[model samples]
Target: MSSQAEHPKTSSSPVQNSIPASSCPQKRTFSACDLNCKTIENKIRKKIKHSWKRILKVCKEKDISNVGEIPVSDFLDIAGKFNLDLSEGESNQITAKYDSKKNGTFAYYDFLQSCVLFLKPKETSLMKRVIIQKPQKPLSPGPQTTSFFSATLRIQPKILHCWRPMERTFKSHDETRSGLLNVSDFKQVLHDYNIDLAEEDLFNILEYYDKNLTSKISYYDFLQAFIQ
Candidate 1:
């Protein structure tokens, strides 16, 4: 009777023993491959910014009309020229992603504008919307133009696959060792390679490649266009 009632044994709640949800570590959403890709992209971006002035100069040189558009091949060349060291796959991905017009050319100025936010995060005001005007329609293709178009479509795939041998062939044909070939030499080289393009087709091809109508073909540039 003198003994005090035993205090009820207090049971600890399960919640009291568990760690708080906010204090628990979060599950990672990115895999190793994702992290690696992100690292590579960051490196590329930094290189691009570091070579900004040089890149702009090259772009200006290519974009003679100040139209802010350049062929995809030239873009890739500029990347290589400046030692950006983009892989073929990386270059392809970039062109596919940024070629908004899907016209085999990219609005490089617009592209730079888009990259400004990533390149210079502090310059948010530079992220203005660019109204890309539709490129002017090329004049109607004559018979030679048509033949050239067909020939290019057929030969480009082969050139991509056998670039080294094709390059050697082109260099072998260059008697001047100047990395250029006149129309006749180019046609002869194509014939030697069994490409079988017509004379008009060859002329049209040269016309397309010779942006300045220089009456000479930079075979290296032509091959680069196809290989890329």
Candidate 2:
């Protein structure tokens, strides 16, 4: 990957839910006797219900669970009500994941929810724009023999043994250097794992070796570096 082309990339779904809407209080369990706060809470509750209905309708079509699927349209409606905006994507090639088609909807909803709860609208509209430049004639990354992306990455809490046995914690592109292992880690974690990764991806994988550094990434944001 060219150093000049490498740019910091991130998944912005989860962080959007950490912040409470401007109309919502910090605490979710306040007594009703506190009428002032209760009024604000009530509004948030009602809004969630109304927004969820419109969002969930689309997810039902995909026959997937509700853990992550929520339409972006519904999320934007709620965020706008609170004068907030939650944005994601890299101006091109927007990416995200879920268990099934339904999950994709929920993931979108989750992203918007997190943003509304935590972030404020930007001074200049926190927007994601697209300027589709002309192709300038078709261009090939390089010779067809070698794929433009030479690296693959997989991240998970632990390895599963349902398909086979487990030995290590994490695996990467280097293992696929050989063509002999067809039924290897190549299929399960990389191809269908829902990582429609960029061709020239860049990011660092930081192993949690030190107990003291319990978690490096914060609730506000996350970072992933994949060099491909």
Find the candidate with the highest TM-score and give its number. 1
- Per-residue alpha-carbon lDDT of candidate 2 for residues 95-121, written as tens digits (9 for 90 to 100): 122112422232443332332221222
After superposition, candidate 1 runs with Cα above 4 Å error = 1-149
Tens digits of lDDT, candidate 1, 1-228? 111111112243111121111111124233543344345456576575556556766887897765556888999988888787888866765655445456666556544433322211121222123111111332222222322333454565456566667667777666556666666666666676677764545545654555455455666555543421
True-vs-predicted CA distance for residue 1, candidate 2, Å: 12
Off by over 4 Å in 2: 1-5, 8-21, 25-192, 197-228
lDDT (CA) for every model shown?
Answer: 0.51, 0.26
Best by lDDT: 1
- Tell me how candidate 1 scores on lDDT: 0.51
For residue 42, model 1's alpha carbon misses the true position, in angstroms, by 19
Which 10 residues in a row give candidate 2 its minimum summed lDDT?
219-228
